[model samples]
Target: MALFVQPWPIFLSINYLGLQACFLRVFMKIKLNNVCIFPLAQILNCVVYCIFVAMAAGLPFLNPYKSTDDADFRHGVNFAVAGSTALPTEILASENILSPVTNSSLSVQLGWMSTHFNSTCKTRGGWCVNQIKYLSFFLKQSTYCVEKLKNSLFMVGEIGGNDYNYALLPGKSIEEVKKIVPNVVEAIKNAVRRVIHYGAVRVIVPGNFPIGCFPIYLTRFQTNDTAVYDEDQCLKELNDFSKYHNDNLRRAIKDLKNEFPNVVIVLFTIILIFCFVMLYTGFDVMSLQKACCGIGGNYNFSLTRMCGAGLPVCSNPNQHISWDGVHLTQEAYKFMTGWLIRNMLHKLQCSV
Candidate 1:
């Protein structure tokens, strides 16, 4: 991600110099395969008036109700696509649950292809680009997105977990991997800052799900020590580690809010809401750690026999939360999205 606001001299020069600087930056950034930065100068020019007003008024003086009226707020959704969690899966998309923006009368002008985190990635056949490398690629693709950034609600991630997943996969002890948490948080913070700089007014930054409850973690870290397991049969240690990550992420977002007080950054704890949804529907929590689709194993997952086309799927995916060891089932995502919109629509200044 690009640092658009740091180091005053370069920032000012880029803006005053004009479009040549902007084009040059875009070309070089694309060449490096880091298509996340905008011409700081160009973006600066676009928001210069707002900045002046905000400064004069003592920071973040933009009113949410200023442009919004009864006819409604028009905004589209965009994912920072790290993998299947944000991707529109066939099961959900077919039911139209995945196309929230499309269903609401806003077209999905840009579609995200599935990509996995480099840490735990098993396959890479689809348009799955690395998030760390291509942060702003989708937003800059068209003028339509650029113009709508001010009103659009951006979902920054279900990210950062893959980084830890990557770390712990190679026989590294949890303690060793815990050190990587701050670095991961920093990367997320940078990405969030970049999106805000691009003119996104509202962003929901979700932290990692409780990995202790994940079948993949249980299968990989199984032990005879009963003390390590929780009442839900999930690993307590790993879940605590996940909490640590979420805490740090939340802190970073708090810091970002201090810097950009006008922007709305909601820290969504998906696991907390996830557990509540599971209990509310009276689903078997034991089945929570079991993959809905897979071949054979203690947790229905194996390095060799994972979820695939030929694998046996659960009688009803709606009854289970996890699809594979990592991703959630469509039913779960549907509920999560519903809960999110009902609760956050007001903050996004969105109605539909």
Candidate 2:
């Protein structure tokens, strides 16, 4: 059920706000520099993890794994690119879905991981042969990359959301988007397999969030029929689609566990956490499906005048769950992160 492990270094391959919450929990546990030091823009863009890791390690914050720079891998490296998907560009394109943001998919992130290892380790015949000299002082000497990675935690996802986002936002029917779940899960499975092969003893692969509960989807898919909405006012069809994705992903993770009994693969139920927060009395239920930073519409969301485009932000973002139309606010993330840590720390088999 859990992998009893030490305080291992974290190697992140993530995307989206759900996994960002988990990273924030780790950052806080490590007692890193105040997260406020990094701009919110950078945090939303998935570029703050390495900076926090670097800062925690007492290293220069400026050299936190930029593509052009030599990344200091003393603590960890983040391979998450915001707006990246689990599915490849070509696959999405074939479905007539276009990725408007960066083309860094799960495969691209894995490629970056490979490149990082290649630079850090001594390789022979394209395989890491000896312990990395620079990392030797920090980590125990291991002959191969796999051995080195055993002491690392791999946060594989909360990816594939953008795949759905790209598809759904472009007017693809829920049924059509539902078909994308298999390929997306397969892509994630392949990524997990690769990380396990690279010697990841513990891996946390999170599922999709309840997108129907978000302001973006609510605004976009508003219907006249009250029957289509749930008790929480979320679109029933969209929430079911999210469940469909999570179910498929859960099955994939089970298969991976069977294949690699030695590895600890965790399926972080992000939707369940969202549900808990929604049901809790403390959360501002009135604004549960509204954007904290946006303008117009019933859900305070507008595709034309999106958040961070100098629109009128709410006076207190802490009172709202949704940050923009899509993402969660910092307070929402903080609360979710706290819940996640309490629930997952035992499963992760790690101490504070």
Candidate 3:
């Protein structure tokens, strides 16, 4: 907990300095074609520029576009890894999906990435190397990314919930979990700042959605006592934590708005986002937190038991609430994304 406290201005300064160094060298060489007295100095600068950029940015992820099945605004991207609350990048990557970066959950993975340019981290030795082929792929496109940082197509970040769950791992109490709320909020702020540092302006920072309702939490934390599950389908305590995170997030966004007057940071809460869906298209909101598709027992949904391997899926997955225990079905994502597109465009006042 103390590790993260007051990391912002310092880390942000280090990050900015790194970016500035890269920008100056790269731009200076581009401008001074053959004018320089020493060509060797330019080459040395180029090598240093790349090393820092790679250190600051873990290899870039493939940019995912909006699902093509829907016809509008197909260029959006989602950085939010499922089952991650700014879930440590390492944990998400452990599942073989995400590459652990600054806000990652996997400590080992984060350490590996930090080892690249930092001398302190280098003593750890051989930490940040991924497959050679992956490294080469990123190197080829690294320069182009800096140029494209402005005018980000779309930004999505949902981070820091897993940290609270981690707090629960070592004999923590409700009071302890409550204490983590502030830190989680700050983590989200840091993550948003990092993305902005990389050049995302029109961003959507989603709130924690119903972690208490997760089937794994319910089954693992269950007591013989009947007071655990609430009628709307989640442990009240977990949902309360979710509510607190979202509330503080709203405040953070307000503060950010004060800080950056021109950018758009929409505080898209799940329910408010859901309400826009219900009103415009009239999607039924039954069991909004319950699994519509999962392999777990009646109410709990999870990947442990996949909903349908080869068998038939729900006839109307859109209408059903839970998709898998941990995620909503593709159909559900469609409606939600559609609603989001409308609201975001409305806020930006731009037509797709």
Best prediction by lDDT = 2
Candidate 2 residue pairs in clash (backbone atoms < 3 Å): none
lDDT of 2: 0.67
Question: lDDT per residue, candidate 1, 221-265, as tens digits?
Answer: 989999999887889988898899899988999999999999988
Alpha carbon lDDT of each predicted model: 0.50, 0.67, 0.43
Tens digits of lDDT, candidate 2, 1-352: 0011112233334311112113333445654222354445522422232333333323343322344666545545566666788887998999999998878787887876666666665444322324444455334333644454655566677788899999998799999888888999998899888867766777878788899898888888888999999998999898899999999999999999999988878888889988887778376877888887788889999877787756777786667778787877666665565665566656756554
**Model 1 lDDT, residue 128, Cα:** 51
Q: By how many angstroms RMSD does model 2 differ from the true structure?
A: 5.8
- What lDDT score is found at residue 196 in candidate 1? 68
Model 1 CA deviation exceeding 4 Å by range:
1-147
Model 3 residue 9 CA deviation in Å? 26
For TM-score, the strongest prediction is: 2
Candidates in order: C-alpha RMSD to true structure: 18.6, 5.8, 16.1
